[model samples]
Target: MHDSVWKFVCLRDLQVPAPCQVAFKWIKLYGSLADGSHSYKIRNNEKHIDWMRIGAFFFDSPVAILSEKLSLPLTILNKDNVEKALESSGACVLSNIKRGIWIADLQLVRCPVCELDTCEGTMQTLEVRNIELFLCDEYQKGSWDYELIGSYTINKSVDAASGGIFDLKHIKDRAMAGVFNLKSWAGKPSDMQPKAMITFHSVAIRTNLQENQGLITKYYAMRAGFEGEVVSIRISQQLA
Candidate 1:
């Protein structure tokens, strides 16, 4: 993966470019459970909606404020059960997480694969199932807003049954209007690998920034006066 591409995506999305035109000092990762309570709550806690678990693969960031009351839907396997769980329990009120950092746009995709991991050829498949838009500017310190401009999804599984996370920048970019796509030069598929299961949680923003910290940093990643520029913005594991 070329560092320039990664930097470009990060900078472009934030509407800033590097002085040297080189994207540096940024890292990308697959959004996953943090283990312990975080993961456990989503799986076991039938009474909560963990919006944070949602992926951040966007083709384009919102150029305009799409919605004032960010209300994105989470794709749950047991829609009714999950809804019931949240209605009955308050232990995991995902909606309580800080909005500024905790807010993210979610897109759900399905990749069905063979149960056996011993399959031949590529054991990965992908497809876009749902496209959701979210906004959390109210939950943040300053006026923040982003929207799902466009998105795309491709099924590239040699084996129809080979399961994989259909999570990638290509799909995100297509879904978010090129706002978020994997750095093509990175030599990595823009899609996310599949997981056995997944869930999402949304937390409300607290007045205190520090209390609701670590939700989202990309917001600060780009600013007119910031050191670096947002050369390119494709939502994925990095911003998820």
Candidate 2:
């Protein structure tokens, strides 16, 4: 058995309302399972939540999106058919589409290379082990009401009495800026995808609470309809 099957699930239930004040925080987590860090100011909301891209990801150096579901969408996210138009414009391709936030083998990584069958130090050769049809946000023709919600912080409680999850005293007592992102871009022992959005979430877990708070809150807000209603978030984990 290994400890690599753990997953952090951030579920903002757009269909319901938050139960209490403690539960009504902008960012909330189930446990210390995700890396909620880094706050990203969203400029656009497409049919897909995308891989948390920045800069010229398409027209220039196609950066590899990190596979931290705690922060970025684990799979392809297409709420409508707006981002899909990128395919025709030669921006990207959405491969292995699925319902909701489910991706199919969409995790990208950086493979290294060397002339002597090895890579070392600053003289290393990094390679992007990408797919055939470079997946990107699609259906870019039908989305509106891109409102700006304030930053959300992933508030955690030290007192784990209620389902070992949340409490008020914890937030008031030991709440720091819980931001989850990458502890740098290098992946484990040998895989480096250079995905900046750790979503460890850096809108994610343990430390990434601040970042998680901001991004996930905006996502919840955008999906929950244009304000004026109770925005509810449901966070859980997956031991896959």
lDDT, candidates in the order shown = 0.23, 0.20
Indicate the residue-level lDDT of 61 in model 2.
17
What is the per-residue lDDT of model 2 for residues 4-56, given as tens digits with 9 covering 90 to 100? 12111223322112222222112322221123211111222221122322210
RMSD of each: 18.9, 20.3
Report the lDDT tens digits of candidate 1 across residue range 30-131.
111122223113222332222333332222211211110112223321355543443343111111111111213222212113334343312111111111
Q: Candidate 2, which segments miss by more than 4 Å at Cα? A: 1-145, 150-191, 194-220, 223-227, 230-240
* Position 236, candidate 1: lDDT: 21
| C-alpha lDDT of candidate 1 relative to the true structure | 0.23
Q: Which number leads on lDDT?
A: 1
Per-candidate TM-score against the hidden true structure = 0.18, 0.18
lDDT of 1 at 232: 18
Count of backbone collisions in candidate 2: 48
Alpha carbon lDDT at 90, candidate 1: 19
